[model samples]
Target: MVPFSLTAAHGSIHASTKQVGCQPLASKGLNHTEQQAGEFRSSRRLVLLLGIASASSLQRPASATPYKEAENIQYGLSNGNIRPCPGGYNPNCVSTASLNDLYSPVWRSSLTSIATSAQVLDSAVMQSSDKAQIVIKRSMPNAEYLEYEVPGLFGRDFMEFLIKADKGAGGAGEENSEGAIVLYRSIAGNVKYLYPFQTAISDFGAQRKRLEAIRQTLGWRKLGCDLKECFE
Candidate 1:
């Protein structure tokens, strides 16, 4: 039962502490065209980094035993029924089951169906996990659940989603017009942000906050846009 930690792309998995950092490219002597090219390259590199964000941080022997489903943190399952963090658990996890304002509301997808929702979730999954570490634990026509080791304090999390055939917000199957209602949730194994004290930096309600970011990111992708353009 060894704990895992992500140290950005620098340290190994299960490192003492996990982290992620960004290093901006030096732009001192570049002319306008070169600087713009550099910025585009940076954005593309960031997209790749995010797709396999946890891979570079893992360090394990070839002989290490494989992880079993029984060892998974059962925050319910990856299906539509995932519940809130366990009683007395740390503040690191969030879910749609939570009525608390700290949790992000479920996301509505631009398209819905076994095919389309799967397309988006599939892309999200690759963006979130290392190929070697992710495991598809459950699957159904309208639902999917996966578990993987991330570079972090606990190094494991579950991502689940269910696609409703109905158009979003009580509308039916407007998968093209309004899309379907998609329920998505992710929960981490780090319940104790701090050993015994919950402070402002403990990442409390973080999962709650990422929803908007995810929405914005998806919008950008659909429009074939990148973050640099927004900033400029």
Candidate 2:
């Protein structure tokens, strides 16, 4: 028979092995809890930060409202748009029918449709083969001009942004501000111009000066007419 002391020692060794195994399992459980807590705290902090950011944004001041464009005239070509008349007209009513009819050829050649409210005129026929300079004069007094060209965008219409500024001499004094409008045009076969809503002659003059400054800074050739009469 085995000695009594030897049996007791064997039991002790078995108990010690079991204790060692259980100690690691308990330590693993503790580590898992700590990891989960850290993740939960991080998520909570993220949610709190997002909520604070949203609240701050809501407290900011609102932007100024934009100016509204004029309504379309009742009579003209294809949708009551102002086109060059068959014959020129009296200087008093330069925007009227007779004057538009006179410039019909130019209007017919370049303009496809004119959006009065948007202050944009789209070129109907694509004149890609020949390089041509397009000129547009509208009856709308406050109508301004911007030109851009893009292919297959805006339903294949040449992109044009209508911009306006005061045509008065006062615009010459202050040319840098948010009130200044910008027009963009691409070199593709698209031809478009932007006209801002009812602006004074002074505003257009100031906008023109700012554009000239940008052109000078970028080393680009000056484009388009800066006639005070046009802006007025």
The candidate that wins on lDDT is: 1
Worst 10 residues of 1 by lDDT: 13-22
> Which residue runs does candidate 2 get wrong by more than 4 Å?
1-132, 139-141, 146-161, 166-179, 190-214, 217-232
TM-score of each: 0.47, 0.17
Which 10 successive residues of model 2 have the least lDDT summed?
103-112
lDDT agreement with native, every candidate? 0.48, 0.31
Per-residue CA lDDT of model 1 for 1-232, tens digit only, reads: 1123222532432132222112233435556686678567656665565456555545765542212222344654533565655324444566656666435455545564546665675666566435425555456544545444444435544554554554333433234444545455665554433334433124544454444354555542222233454312
Give the per-residue lDDT of model 2 (tens digit) for 20-48.
Answer: 44575466565766656755665565556
lDDT of 1 at 213: 51
Cα error, candidate 2, residue 157 (Å) = 13
